[model samples]
Target: MSVTIDITGLPQERIAFGPSPLAELGAALHALSEPGHHARLHGWTTTTAAGLKPELADRLHEADFMWRSTRSDILLPAQPRETLAEELDDLDRMDDERYVAAALEINCAGFYDRSGPSPLVDAAMRQRALDLAAARGPRQAAFVRRMLADPPGTRAWIRRLLEDCDEAFFADTWRRVHVQLATDARHKTELMRRKGLSGAVAAVSSALTLEEDAHGSRLVVDKLSDGRTTAQGSGVTFLPTAFGWPHLIALYAPGWQPVIQYPVSSGELAGVLPVETVKLRLEAVSHPLRMRLCRNLARASYTTSELADAYGITAPEVSRHLAVLKKAGLLSTRRRGRYVMHQLDVAAVARIGSDFLEAVLR
Candidate 1:
């Protein structure tokens, strides 16, 4: 009935947590592109309707098999990779044999009921892309052909799909919302530090939840893959999701470290910014000078003098406004060599007036 991840054999020290850009990106892709998952993933449809051109929609609908109901193939985490480039780099590090094997594995109806290894694919490797291309569905076949001909290019295309959908669906919205997500992720990290490993894993979801059993730790997720998999010396990583709502995705390639992604707590993801924070954010744009400063930083990060020179204001005034926005968490600053650059939090303005999410749903 559920996939039991036996971590009893592994050390507690091996349990880890971090967010995966690939996992989140894959979930966003499915939520935005796949027709079969549209029911639970319903939120993305109206938001992406504008940017999803007719031709792209047709292609996505037809190529649904590549990102099928399970979506396990695309969720593989050979190692703990937090960025897109890092994940793809990890994929490339996989031997051709291992890569080919994991690429074809799927989660099936029988998988959940089995005591044995997954019944999705053979242990023996095959020419993965060619095999997928030979599938009965023309859409799947076409999609596989494209992947084979240009692997990097295909991944880039998929990335663009996620990015474009995020932009068009929300009207540059998710920025501020993401700050909440990041804040939640940080809180979870603090939980793990205080409560130990079990509490941390338990925090991810109640629906597709994680728990400890006599055998080891278990992750009960909403999917067909229902076989117990042992860490078998390879550890597991837990990642938090911000944009990836309503779905729990996992990576269980037979020979690799597993990664389970769960939705962050909604309580943390939503709710108004504190009244004071909201007031400060509003004030950040009220001044013609502050508004201009915020607008310039929106395009690119700037130093105090760089901003002052651009706006014909003095460095002192620029620094003062930047200080207020930074305190509001509406701007992020990072030190680069000798210069400290402030970047517009982008998530700043929508703290209140923009009901863009509500607009998308309508």
Candidate 2:
């Protein structure tokens, strides 16, 4: 199954590039909560997760679904503003009907009864939403019910969540990664100019390809879902994000601009420290916590949270240790449900000595 976006008449000037702090913030939340999905972000996720306040942590837990799938415009606005504050204000200033409708659509997990009257006004649609939410879980069902009952209150709660997330971690994170995102955007823009849209698309991800036929040009994204959306008047917006690595988020929600948020290219980050990479791997296992983690992982795979509990350490601390080991190329990961399961790369660890010698000799 795949999603094809028809960009038949998409103008050259319509091809845009920029960084969205609000979008990145949403991606960060998704990465933090679903650590197993973004192995490349192990270091940043752990450090940020450790610093979150208790209240913020609880709120994030409850609202995990909103950010996880990137399905809703409320979380990731189709058109990003220059700053997060501006983006939040845009959301705040949105008309009540539009705001509530979007929230309701997301709360129901994309279950919309379009066959009925206008959204939020149709009784059948509300019932449909409630029915779908019920199947997901109790928490999700409750949230949908509350959204139907009091939309303004729910909107306020969502606003507070975004603010809290920013103050807790995203604000600082933006400052650190925004420059890199901008650099990536420039690189992509050049690629599009030099090699055309297909080249830029390929640079973003292998899962994305451009196809042309009698129907016109379409950007086909390799996704689990099957659907097609024609480019609306707003054209396509390409967003680069630092925290959204190892996965691409393509938003094709109706009544909104089509968006593709991809991980910033890391090719430019190739450092001159080939030997240092090997040293990092060796030094990573030398740490007492990491050594134990390596040994335990050698026996069985474990999530960051599970390892933290077993070692009587904070999750952030375990994450920090795990990040080092992963960077050293001594760790590997896979996803099991919502959690990232970690395992030791025994062969990589064994090759460290030989790798060091080869690098030094060369």
Candidate 3:
């Protein structure tokens, strides 16, 4: 029997960032916005600022010193809700052209160093400032208002504005925005944090371009820094023995590139399936008693005796099933007090399902 379910009727809400100069400015600032939430993002500002003109570099340094000495109290707070909310409201009320001009001016002033102002910075700043100020309200309200005023074509004005902001201001603004975002989405941030540190570490790793190995069956993972592992054998069927499959998938999805690298030793078998592994996975999946045990353990950890009583099976039968599943990499065991508790290996199960389907199709 086959089951088919169509999901075409689902409603989707698409988030569109419109073309206002100020809005573009805001969007550009997004990378720098959230501060305390992402420590890795700090590199963006420092790295970008290193290449600025000499005068601008001096100004950035001065601004950093000034900010450290004077505004430390305001900037060091755990949260800046009232300030951010006010800024956002102001940005919403501004006109695109005017807001863009104002933002540009702000950026230029922020970025200008002791060498004096450059025409590029001056022209760009004036344009953005006018774009932002054209709209009306408080600072943030005006920013948003201007950003939403026109179509995205005016984004050039905002980009120019960002380029002129001194490194100090750019970094500071980025941190502020990041903190606001983190405050708004505490739950998601916590979940990501618990998943493991691999994602966070990878985000900051040096970029490496991947290429197919000579064998045509594997991708070589290279461009590693320091003493980290650079390459490993990888495939849809190359199941992980630690942390199971879900964690592995999360770590190696398309969006999260440069993960585990494929080796050159594996020969190309483009359409071929690993029949033996598939058979093993299928047999693992078809064991009804094992499935029942997994479902029960998912709710709460259970001992063989407890599981046996719950499922109305003998203690020895439960033990046998647990042992088999454990050996199959579908379950994990830990001893608590005098009893051993069992839990489903969620990652392993997911990998088994994925590998089984892939093998059958191949």
lDDT of 3: 0.35
* Candidate 1 lDDT by residue in tens digits, 252-328: 64555666776674321134777887677667566656655654454345667666655567899888888877776
Q: Which candidate number maximizes TM-score?
A: 2
Winner by lDDT: 2
Q: What TM-score does each of the candidates earn?
A: 0.54, 0.68, 0.25
TM-score of 3: 0.25
- Model 3: runs farther than 4 Å from truth? 1-275, 354-362
RMSD of each: 20.6, 11.9, 24.2
- Sort order, TM-score high to low: 2, 1, 3
Q: Give lDDT for model 1.
A: 0.53
Off by over 4 Å in 1: 34-44, 54-63, 76-82, 107-136, 145-178, 207-225, 265-362
Candidate 1 has a TM-score of: 0.54
lDDT of 3 by residue, 1-362 (tens): 11111112211111010112222123223323222111234475456545556765443333231121111111111112333334344444544443333333322222211223322335554454343233211443344343445424334433333346624354454454444333423432343366522232232122222233353222222211111211222211111111111111111211111122111111111233367755665576577666556644432346676666556789999888887777776677887546576866544554455433222211
> Model 2 TM-score?
0.68
Off by over 4 Å in 2: 69-71, 104-119, 135-138, 265-362
Global Cα lDDT for candidate 2: 0.69
